[model samples]
Target: MLDYDREAARYDATRGGDARAEAAAEAVEELLPRQARVVVDVACGTGIVTARLRRPGRRVAGIDRSAGMARMAAARLPGGVVCGDAAARLPLLDGSADAVTMIWLLHLLDQADSAAVLAQAARALRPGGRLLTTVDKNHAAYHTGGDVAALLGPVRDAHTPPQSDALDRVLGVGSGLGLTMSGRTTFAGLGQGRSPRSWREVIPKSPWGRRMDAATLAELGSRLGDLPDQDHPRPDPVYTLIALVKQD
Candidate 1:
């Protein structure tokens, strides 16, 4: 993944800013309990969405591996932001939170790391507590057209996260740890859709692109160059959030 510490500065701007943050928080909330007392958002980059998730009864805290990202989150949430690795053990105690969330996180990891993060999320939740996270992230990048989606085939399947039939496996991972899928929700990616040319520039920085062979990347670039609307944004995707509950 791109250096999150380096990316922290431009994260919100490149992402959909507050408007997108609000939309994401709302979607996550829809999958959360109506009255959760403690909610910890793992990999809460910059705490933008975490801040918006604060509700009357909810006490929100953010944890991230990027010190730079955590600094920004700390400013927004004070001491509520803990600079820590989500793939390893968090400083949190077991069964400490009513809800644990890892939004837009899992797809960024390899299969092993994604499982570790999910394990951590499950460890941080109380029995019967909910764990909400985003999955099928790359799929969102192409809610626009078959052409764009076809070109990004490799990137689209670069994850072990929930999306389409893959969701069954994701739930299986959670179920093995006593976390079962209970519900889900979706939100507009707003301002996140991209055209082929622009997406070509993004390939190298993406998780899949980082590991892609030079020949394949070159071919992808060639294909992208052939597409129309070189600079225009495509249709914004509907991002999905899956909610799982920890069994007692």
Candidate 2:
């Protein structure tokens, strides 16, 4: 595991303000009841999403394994933020949170650990409280074409992108731990559909999109240039926001 502590400062810069974070936040907000108050942002890197959750009367907390990440999150959030691992025991009490949000973090865990994390999230949520998570689409089996090797630079190892269905299955495992699916939202167009024109026109338009420097942006354009047109069917990275509610 990359110690996100050392990389916390630059992680958001590298990923840009991930759109998945916004989508996940929206999902959580919508799923939460009007009275729900306390919310936990799990695997909160640099507190970007946590900052967005700050509002009057709504208590927000952030938890992450990286001390650096927690520090960043705490600086942005007025609520309590703790440095802790998501896979193991969370530093919160059972049924302490009214809602939980996990963004762009599940796929990082292997199958077993992922389930453990989900279970722990469920444990922390009060009965009927919601849990929102964004999971990557199944790309390893569906992705074809595009200069993946060139874009990533130096293929270190053969890794499979977690299947969307596999993520659902993991959630199912957490069902035994008392979480039921309430709703879902999907956000697509991550790391795909970058044309030279769109890259130039769109990449600089948003904070998350603006992190790419001129060189990296040009390199991405060049590598993707050889591929079929953006219209071509490809494995688009989809972020699925699953809303799970704790069953009483």
Candidate 3:
């Protein structure tokens, strides 16, 4: 996981920025029930997308674990953001929120913590309300079917941990907690593609990459270096979102 406090300053620019935020918010809104008025965005880093989720007659607030990230969120939504750990508890009353969103949160946590966060989200949601979240976040980058994926797919999969936000895992967990899948959508991660050189730089710092042997890392770096258009980014990744509605 990243030191979100340190990354907060550059989070939006480095991420897909406004373009990506717009697409994500549009998709989320589509899945959200029109009657949903009280929405809570869990782990709503920087509130970039959270702010965009707002609409007339609807109230949206954000919750984040990092003070730095929450500060930025609070600026976008003054008096509407809280700094707290969603995996443990949400500050909202039980069955208080009409909707809860976890945009890019679960992939950062281990399975146990991810389950805890899902449970907490369920606790805060009203019956018939929905929980919207992204799934398979870390692996979305490879689904573009670019040369970078072809070269590193096998190795990457072998080194990667069990993803907490994988579609099946999420579905199963949500079902167990009385949150059944109600909708699904995808959005392009605009301007968030990686080049061969960029992959070489970031791979070594990734969670899976940290477990790779030095010689293997060096060889993978060499392979990435040999690819053409080292600085030209490949196709953008399309991220998946699923809406789970709480049963009465």
Per-candidate clashes come to: 0, 1, 0
Best by TM-score: 3
Per-residue accuracy of model 1 over 1-248 as CA lDDT, tens digit each: 78998999999998999989999999888888887899999999999999988888679999999999999999999879998888888778999999998888887777788888888889889999999988777667755566787667655465323432246657878988999999988888788888777888988777567777888778878888998888877778788888999999
Off by over 4 Å in 3: none
**Alpha carbon lDDT at 6, candidate 1:** 94
Relative to the unseen true structure, what is the C-alpha lDDT of residue 79 in candidate 3, on a scale of 0 to 100?
Answer: 97
The alpha-carbon lDDT assigned to residue 199 of candidate 1 equals 87
* Candidate 3 per-residue C-alpha lDDT over 47-89 given as tens digits, one digit per residue, 9 for 90 to 100: 9999998899999999999999999999999999999999988
In terms of lDDT, which candidate is stronger, 1 or 3? 3
lDDT of 2 by residue, 97-201 (tens): 988888777767777778878888888989888888875443321233345433432321122234423555757676788777888776654444334344335
Task: State in Å the error of residue 19, model 2.
Answer: 5.9
What residue pairs are clashing in model 3?
A: none
Which candidate should be chosen as best, given lDDT against the real structure?
Answer: 3
Which is the better candidate, 1 or 2, if ranked by TM-score? 1
Off by over 4 Å in 1: 154-166, 204-220
Candidates' RMSD to native:
3.0, 8.1, 1.2
Taken over the whole model, the C-alpha lDDT of each candidate is: 0.84, 0.68, 0.94
